[model samples]
Target chain A: MSLDFGLIIEQMPDILSGLWVTLWIWVVASILGAALGFLVAAARRYGPAPLDWLLKLYVEILRGNPFLIQLFLLYFGGPFIGLRLEPIPAGLIGLTIYASAYFSEIFRAGFQAVPRGHVEAAQCVGLSRSQILRRILLPEMTMLVLPQCVNMAIILIKETAILSIITVPEMTMVIGAIGSQQYAFVDAMFLLAIFYWVLVEICDWLGRRAEAKLSKFRFAVT
Target chain B: MSFKLFELMLWAAGYTVVLSAISIVIGLTIGLCVCAAKLARSRALSIPATVFISFFRGVPLLVQLLLIYNLLPAIGISVPSVVAAVIGLSLCTAAYQAENLRGGFNSVPKGLLEAADMVGLSPWQQLKRIRAPIALRLTLPALVNEAILILKASSLISVVGVIELTRMAQNLSASTYRPLLFYSVAGGLYLVICWTVAGGGALAERLTRTSRA
Candidate 1:
């Protein structure tokens, strides 16, 4: 089949709107996930025993199951809990929760990689626990966390496509609608793939650049 | 509503297990082949194999599932939805498994191959007797992890209307309007399956460690 530049151009604006929804989903999910991930990481690190156990269980439950199932639970199950969320909100919540679990593990890895000697040195200088955490631990952890975080972000972005199943107006949903409407299944899907590819490539590029920047610090440390 | 939800959960759980098992078997076989081809010396074979691995690895599984389930029929091969889902999952899982197996292969010492050759072993015998056993042992942990990942990913098959665990949860929620209870149960089942797989991986790792010592 010949490539259809004309059809692509014609569909560009509509696809852009769908892309906007996808971007919104990614941005919201990333922020919430990062926040929740940090909290879980901190809890697992410094919280009391019961809280640590709870956080551990939360992380395992979220990581062990598929995001699609979590999406179903939230989109369909929220109503039974007396909180009826819209499709977009439900999808975002589910993705955020799922992403948090993965990111928390990444965060924990980063935190553990921070040498205990460094924290001990900070203590020698009379830095309080909170001060050491804020000043030394977090700055060092960011370098370790950023690369994996960016990779997870790409995964989360692609995952948003699954939300289309719950009637969220993301890019995949748009592709599905267009395919059904115009009987342009192959064309619409090809376009959709391009959209996702571009997003993933951009995220990967950013991740590599960040990793490069972080590695320079490693050289200085050694 | 309660009884119906219980029935749906049981039914869906059964299908999920069956699908996961089939995909794992197919995926492991194809993955080993692709991994071997990738590690082969022939540029002609390795280059295409590498490209195939990257193509599947790069795209999301959901998109691949859609492409296989919805788009393939238009190209004249009308696979059933279940078949398409299985193929899509197996293909995706194989790409990951191939990468994992390549790591195991790389861990095999070059001296072993030379030793096998000095003993007048054929290439096939060297691979079967010297390479496969050690590689499989080293890679067992990673293979188990991938199995769990594939099992969880199989839930995506429900998108094409396979009556798997996730789909059953969706159907039950709609029918009973008791979404919380049904979904929680479905989610619980998934957790159990994954935890069991993970526990098995840990056991295998421990056994391997003891054996090596």
Candidate 2:
């Protein structure tokens, strides 16, 4: 069978729809993941012994296991637990949990990078712990953490493709469906790869811009 | 439900180890070659090598695996799903490893290469005797990190029906309807593997420091 350029082109709208779904999931999950990551990092840093251990365990479980399994559990096993989430919500939950673990590590590193003197200075000024963390620690760590957070965001975007397995109709699943139907698997996959590549390029561009803005703050400190 | 789930978890853990080993070896070998090519003098060779590294490193492993597993059959080159999984994973591993190796190579002082040249060492001899040892030392931490990443990424292979640890957990969950128990076990095995690798790397670093002293 010969390649059908026309057929592949005709399917572009369908594939683009899936691409939008993938992007939407990534954006929502990344926001949630970043919020959760900050909380996990804070708990690990200053919480009680049990809370610290619990946070550590949560991070390790999410980090060590594959996102695919986590997605499987969330999507397929949710019904058994009486949750009964749809594919998109399940995908969002899985990606957010998985990404949070990694983002927490980045946040931890970033927090650690903030000079101890800065925190001490805040303490000497009679600032409360929460005030010090909010004003002094966060602004200082933001520069260190922003690049890594952006990189993790890109990774989260790429990982959203795995949701296709749970029948989320993400870009990969759409390509697979179109390929099987048209028997133009190679062409379809090639096009799908280009789509992902373009998405990644855009993310990289944004990451670079963020890095540039953050690095000015970093350099001013050094 | 409990006993059966325990048996499945044990079996899956074993398979996870085996597949991780295979992918690591394959990834390292291909990674070395790709690294060498990227550093080669010829633009003709290194240009494509650069593109290959960027492409694989940029794309997600799941998409790569799906494309390979599904598209190969369409081209009348029908390998088993496992074979495709290995190929896809190894290629991704090679890409990341190549970048790490390049960093390793960059860390070698230029004076060391000049010294090797003055000693009349053949290029291959210099590479084996002088470069490889130093590069390996410099790259060890990064390599260990990559190994950890590979171990985690191997779970993506389950999408194409490899029945590795993650797949086993999924199956067990289906049978017993105990997602938490089976998934926790699988996650524990992964923690063990990752912790072992990190611990081993730390030990090696300590040992090397002592030896240097």
Candidate 3:
């Protein structure tokens, strides 16, 4: 059989609704993940030695395994720990945890790459620890890390598709349900591709814009 | 949890490893061709390569898998779940790998190639003796990193009905009604496999470095 544009148009409502859920999850999870990752990186950098080791383990275990398994553990295994959650919450938390692990690594690298001399110079000038962090470290690291954070965000966007497996009603799941019922799996897949491709492109464009803005800070600081 | 259950998990882990292994090999071969096409001067060759990379890289792998699984039948070419899964993983990884390979090739020193030309080395000789080796070395760490990513991503194949490690965990957990134990065990197994592969990659890199030196 030939391709059918008509089927896609007919299912536009379902696709749009699905895409809304995708964007919601993507935005919420990304913001939470980035915030949490920043904290974890900062803690690892300036926290006590034992705390640093524990945080490193946290980063490793999360990063080492597949995210699908993590989601499974969080969602399916939640009841055992008396932490039952709806699919949306579970998806959000899972994605947050997964994204944070990656984001923290990026943050840590950026934080470390700010030369030691820069920090020492700030200290020599009698800058308070908080002052140095806010005035000197964060700006430099943000410029260095923004591009990677954007890359991770794109990866996380792709990952939001997996939440569909847990019945999250995201684009993948919605399209998948339509495919099964209507036997228009090919058309459904086509729409899914378009939705996801556009999402990634939007994310990429925003990233480039942010990078352009931040480069001025980078130049000023250097 | 039980010995029998753990054995089943290991058995399924075999599928995960084997599938990732097959896909990486096929992806590398395909990636090489795509990288060549992308770096080629002709618009006819480069344009399609660029589109292939853009579509594959831009779209999610989950969608690609679903598309392959469903679209094949519509085109009168039905494939089994495993084949569809392999095609999806290979193509998706190929796009990323091609980009990586292209970056590696692009970084090869122009002066070195010119020096080879001065010695009267043919283009093929130049590629074999100089460009290929240098590009391969520069690309090695990225290639290893990609391999690990693909291994972790192999979990998504379960969506297409391949009973790899993640699928087996879901199955065993559902049957035993012990999601916590089974999922944790599965996660641990994945950590072990990933660490081992990462170690092997590190070893390989060291070997190549020392041999070259």
* Model 1, span A1-222: residue lDDT tens: 333445655777777888899999899999899999989998898899999899999999998888887887777776767879999888888889999999899999998988888999999999998999899998899987888898889878878888888999988887768776776766667767767777777788888987997787762343
Mark the regions of model 1 whose C-alpha exceeds 4 Å error after superposition: A1-5, A121-131, A219-222, B1-5, B108-131, B210-213
- For candidate 1, the per-residue lDDT at A35 reads 92
What do the candidate models score in CA lDDT, each in turn?
0.84, 0.84, 0.90
Question: How does chain B of model 2 score on TM-score?
Answer: 0.92
Superposition error at B17 for model 2 (Å): 1.5
Q: Which lDDT tens digits does candidate 3 get at residues B1-213?
A: 679888999999988999999999999999999999999999999999998998898898888988998788778897889999999999999999999999988888898899999999999999999899989888898998988899899999998899999999999999989999999988999999989988998998888862332
DockQ, every prediction? 0.54, 0.55, 0.84
Error of 2 at B157 (Å): 1.7
Ten contiguous residues minimizing lDDT sum, candidate 2 chain B? B204-213
Q: Best by TM-score, which number?
A: 3
lDDT of 1 by residue, B97-213 (tens): 899899988888898899899999999999899888888888898888888888889989988988899888878777767778877888889998889889988987887752441
Candidate 2 — what's its lDDT?
A: 0.84
Model 3 chain B worst lDDT run, 10 consecutive residues:
B204-213
What is the C-alpha lDDT profile of model 2 across B93-150, one tens digit per residue? 8888998999988888888889999989998998999888888888888988888888
1 against 3, candidate with superior lDDT = 3
Scored by DockQ, the top model is 3
- Candidate 3 residue-pair clash tally: 0
lDDT at B144 for candidate 1?
Answer: 88
